[model samples]
Target: MKPPDARHSQAEDARLLTDQNELARQEALNGLRQFDAVVEMVEYHLQPEHRFRFRPSHLLHLHRLALEGISSYAGTWRPASIQIEGSRHQPAGAHRVPELIEELCDYVNDHWQECTPIHLAAYVMWRLNWIHPFTDGNGRTSRAASYLIPCLRAGYLLPGKQTIPDQISQNKKPYYEALEAADAAWSERGTVDLSAMENLLAELLARQLVEVLDHATGGHVTLPSAKENPSS
Candidate 1:
């Protein structure tokens, strides 16, 4: 390996950047704390036991429903009822739904050795959004599950931050655009390929993991990538 590309250089920056005093650490911890609770609710709703597990807008709607006490019956899946996309009222691709997530799980389960779980998770998320299965909240739901897998992986893979949107969030629209652009590519060609996706995903995760390492550790590297075979 040629070390990480520049896009993946956050770890090196982290090593240099995290020697701040207690005050800075406190500030960072505070931000992480707020973010933590938000993600927790998001991830819990992602579990299969949630009944609405694969429903596209379920996660996003659940967030508002849980925190704001918004009223609506739960787990109803219909094009108009559960929509998610840049444009409203547009039905997602045929593959966009809980099955897309299940397929991601299946892919990661079998190919952990061949691909980084973080990268695979990112790709899965990308596909989920493109499918645009729901009528309302696919982005938030995919975003939640994307974060959730790593949290689960951290519990199982290593001792690091459970979520990683910090880095991904640094450039939000670009991330969304990348995914949407890939979808556009698929629309033109009528196919999607995971390998083409991995390149973008690798850049996203290697950097995002480094950011998560900082975010969860009060700006220090408390939780490293515990993944046994992280490509890095």
Candidate 2:
């Protein structure tokens, strides 16, 4: 069988790409595939007997799916230092990535029972982004894994038109601000504060569910608009 068009030839290895347009196209395609795979993963874990386990391997799988045709470092931890553009917080050194990721999974698994779904989801999102494990696709992988947490915790996939990650991707200013808020708390007092991120996810998740309800009822129910209350 012929390989998928997106994975054909030069697209098979992003390192060979020189044209900016091809790179952009491939990234977009990879992103779609990544999200589809994430949804599949969530569905698999939603089964009655299957339980979700937060692990470094899951993160790497998501990261690989996220950047399969965009970077050679797709699934592997970076071997050198990295920087987060437009952010003052310095990520852990490359050598520290493995340990940091392990700690992240440990935090989620350790707090799995005690924490609320939103809190756990927020922690996964913030801590994974804070770790910045890969050379690229960090945000995408983080969002995918975070979304998975809530779905697994609920024992079923969450209903939505636009996912929490899709909402955040559409408007990143608030997402970045929430991340910075968590970072500030962490840096100042060594706290794992994720209230800002929790609130953000709560709002987005509400909006997503509202959309589902609206779709189900054929738009008869007029819910308050998320657009009008941007500050809320």
Candidate 3:
């Protein structure tokens, strides 16, 4: 098999590409693979006798699984600075990644009870993006981490036909806006404000619950104009 095209490389690794069409195809396949992985991980954690502890290693492993075939630096932090295209936010310096990620893990584990599930999930998603730890697949990994938050907190995997990550992927504009809002709050006030992201996630989870319920009852339910309440 020929080496995958690297004409649109996004990182030092030539294997990471930015070709929209190819990237889209790879992402679709990767999303499915990651979905299965999330289910398995959630199930394993939910086992009656198992004790689940949130760890930075889980996020690293998720990143590895998410970009397994596309990026050579899938599970590793970037060795050089990265510029997020079209975003004003600058991620932490490469040298600070380990410390930052350790801090994130500590925050999540320590405050797991103080915060709501949506708040916790949104924080993970935004903080991961802000860190930009990996050379690639940071968004996917963060989104997966977001999903894992609620599951781990609930002590059971949440049921849904369309997960929060899937919803975020379908229409990223609002997701980006929410993340940007959180970023702005952090930059200006030196505080974490995840209200926007939490609201969006709450909406997505509600939609997922509705969809799952519809399927469970064998009913084709359609809500009011999706524009008024976009789920996808």
Name the top TM-score candidate. Answer: 2
Each prediction's number of clashing residue pairs? 10, 0, 0
Whole-model lDDT values for every prediction: 0.47, 0.81, 0.82
Q: What residue runs in model 2 are displaced by over 4 Å at the alpha carbon?
A: 1-16, 222-232
Clashing pairs in 1: 82-134, 82-135, 82-136, 83-134, 83-135, 83-136, 84-134, 84-135, 84-136, 92-132
Q: Residue 223 deviation, candidate 2, in Å?
A: 6.1
Lowest lDDT 10-mer window, candidate 2?
2-11
**lDDT for each residue of candidate 3 in 1-232, tens digit (9 for 90 to 100):** 1221111114566477578898778877887888787888888878878766678788888888788777888778888887777677788778999999998888888897898989989989999989888887888899998899898888778888688888887888788888788888899899999999999999999998988878877776666875685555
* lDDT of the structure predicted as candidate 2: 0.81
lDDT of 3 at 11: 51
Superposed model 3: Cα runs more than 4 Å off: 1-10, 16-24, 218-232
Q: Please give, for residues 88-151, the per-residue lDDT of candidate 2 as tens digits.
A: 6788887999999998999899999999989999998988888777776778888888998888
TM-score of each: 0.48, 0.86, 0.84
The Cα error of candidate 1 at residue 126, in Å, is 1.5
| Order of quality (TM-score) | 2, 3, 1
